[model samples]
Target: MSDNYAASFSINQPGRDAGILPVNQPGRDTSTSEQSHTEPSANGGSTVSTRENVRPGVSYLAGRLEFEPSIASKLDALITEFRDGKSTKGNTVFEAYDFVNSFPGGTPETRKFALSEFLSTIDSVEILADAARRCGDRAQIGLNHADTTATPRIEYTANAPNDNALIQAASQIGSKRARSEALSDADVGPGRENDMDYRSGEKRAKLTTADLPWHSEALAARQDGRVSCQATQDLLYRYERDPGWVRRQVIISGVAPPTIPPGEWDAIFRGTPVNLDAVFSSVHHVLPPKEDVGRVGSTEIRFSNPEPSKRIQTANDWTTAWDDVSEATAIAFPHRARELKEYGSYIRSEFSAKMPSSHRKIILYDIAIRNFVQGGQRHLLTDFHLFSRFHSAIVAPDGVVSGSGSGTKPGSSSRGRAGGRKIDGSKSEVCHRFNDVGRTCPFSTASCRYIHSCKGCGSTGHGQRDCVQSGRDSRSTS
Candidate 1:
């Protein structure tokens, strides 16, 4: 503290130490002197001073320094005196800025920090503009300046304005006097405003669907069945074919059903009721024989013709055509499972009717497989090869085709039990003769001589309890 300010302020010369001049020191300029300095010459010949003009306490090399008290201390003294009514007027931002500029010899870094503090503490824009003109880097200093910088930095303090305070500020911005007043005085704290409360679009409230007058009319139309969901769906369908017509019917009229063409009315209403009889007939190709078809539950056998065109037909001619082609294909290729798309295409070609969707075809396939399994536990056919052969044999007028993948064709009575014998833990010389019939081992030399084989793939290397391939094979065999 022993003249640290003076020692810090003076630049290093040849011999003269930067001496401390105490406030009480007599015969020395202490009233904030500027312009020139009388110092003993470096060569000790006479008093020397800088030719370039130097401000009060600042010079090019040495920055401004504390005298008896620092600039901060002096500002604090002025503030306290003004608060106590000892000064002629209140401490204003202009006064604080003037006090800072008076000391023109301070370091650039020190001056910036001091100027930032003054700008932050003062609320007046005029004072801030003046400071910006005098400062070296106006943008840099302005960015760091904040009204709360004067407050002591501490832990866990809210430093932004809250929502209520911001609302109050926006409300008061209309008045000049209110704009001039401090945000803190307007009860605005120094914390951020919650974004949820500060939406920046048109200030008017948003309207919901229920707020529209037409909403009630639309609801009434629907409740009275004057506006059918089917009609709306038909409009969507027509949108794919004739978009302009659909737009006139739907968009122009606000989806009113009366806007639709008269030609489309009968089809829309007729398509609403599903033709379950035709659906059952198209899917019947996959069902078990007549006696075993009853085991399939009605709930498990759900089918729907997603295509609107098919649902419009009343003659059930499409089902009869599909049955003929499917039965013909089964008889000709008894060793192959029928392809859904191929069967669908043939029906469309012969009858010139649009086929059901792939989704509907898949549903039909699922129903067939499920019913085939539901016929009997021993009669389950999981292999595609066996399923095709068994289907062809059933539909074949002459007993020409059989359900065997190899020689020694099993008869119709034995065909159902063939799948059972494969999994029934019984051994036969024909099954054991090849030695590789059911062995799952990677090596071809591995043999299956045991009585028990896997219920899944008929493999003998692993039992059903430990087999991994068993479950996978069960899903795709038939």
Candidate 2:
């Protein structure tokens, strides 16, 4: 069985009290000047003392309880034994040492608990010295061996209390103390030479390194272009095997296309051009005829050509010309055109939802502007403008008109209503004053311009069902 040992203890200065003293009066000596300065002499006589001669010991243990709870519980038993007069010694270091050593393995955790309990009765330094003496006695056989390597690993075995789990808990407690005052491995217990297997049967605890934050930061530095990807990967693998490397590789692959020999480009682009013209012609033949002037409402109404020319006359015009041809062909074709339009609209709506609103608006605006410039139609631009104006009116401060008029300034009457609404019974007053003026009072009318109002009461004064005065009147009548 593996040996179990908990961390040891170190003395530190206790926390200071934060309470403030009462204010001193003008004649009061707040300073230590008027106080008696005397010290108790070794011979039990008074001696002259100064502030410089005074030194204070730690008032509280500035450390954590190092033992597991189970081992610490045993201290209560010892305390009971002491109270019952069954304990052999009284208020001595040897008594604590003997009590702790009685455990099957005087593991560090058990020792620490014993020290804490002993200090509750005696002093910390004395308890620590006693523990060291006890450890020295147990390890005495191997102490004088000239072969420094020949040391038996003490195996802690007992079921009454287990300290194994906490013994391997990382060194944060010991590291918090100053290096000089820190507990050494020797203070805990001698490490096992033959007891190599340290695996615990309890749930396996994850081992986290102290420098994890630094490692993550280093990887981020590489991602942000401070270092090469290969360098980052190497650094990461040095600490732990991470699956994130695969994701990083995929991202790098996407951003940078793999290099291909110049000879491959010609072969790739040599394929025959798609017969877009034939496709458009076939679509035009199968489509319904354009609407007649009488059918749509005016004799002067002329439908523009449903199919644009497909051939690209200039390099700059190719993309625009191709797009127009494709669009016109789709509009002319009946079944396929309707299906394509619906599918395209669905895709655009989904993409718009996923994209930021600002980005979506910019894209929509660009498409509308392009359609207008191409002499396609004016109604699309008109719709775009209306939508943009409505969106701005809802979001922009100046776009929001406060009054019935379209002017940007907040109306004087609106401000008056807002101020008057705070007064009791002002709802009836405002309604009588404004009802005939074609401006409904925000207080009493259902057609009130103010958005925040109680729908049930038809008044801005208070909610109908929760009215306190109404409830009181009902109770009185009952």
Best model per lDDT: 1
**Per-residue lDDT over 1-478 for candidate 2, one digit per residue giving the tens place of the 0 to 100 score:** 0144432322222243323222222232323221213334354433322122112221111122333334444554554344333454344335555656665654555554445435443322222222233233221222222124322322222333535333332222223222212122332211221121221112343233322557556445545642223332333232123223332343255432122111111111221122333333333343433323223442233333234333222222223323433353232222234433443454345335532322223233333333332221112222343455543543233445212121113434432233344222111123333323223444423223233333333454543333354343222332
Give Cα-based local distance difference scores for all models.
Answer: 0.33, 0.32
Clashing pairs in 2: 6-109
The alpha-carbon lDDT assigned to residue 440 of candidate 2 equals 45
Per-residue lDDT over 284-335 for candidate 1, one digit per residue giving the tens place of the 0 to 100 score: 3343212111226422221322332222121144454334433432222233
- Runs in model 2 lying further than 4 Å from the true structure: 1-390, 394-397, 400-462, 469-478
Alpha carbon deviation, residue 347, candidate 2 (Å):
16
Each model's total of backbone clashes: 14, 1
Runs of candidate 1 exceeding 4 Å displacement: 1-70, 77-91, 120-478
What is the TM-score of each predicted model, taking all chains together? 0.16, 0.15
lDDT accuracy of residue 78 in candidate 2:
52
Candidate 2 lDDT score relative to the true structure: 0.32
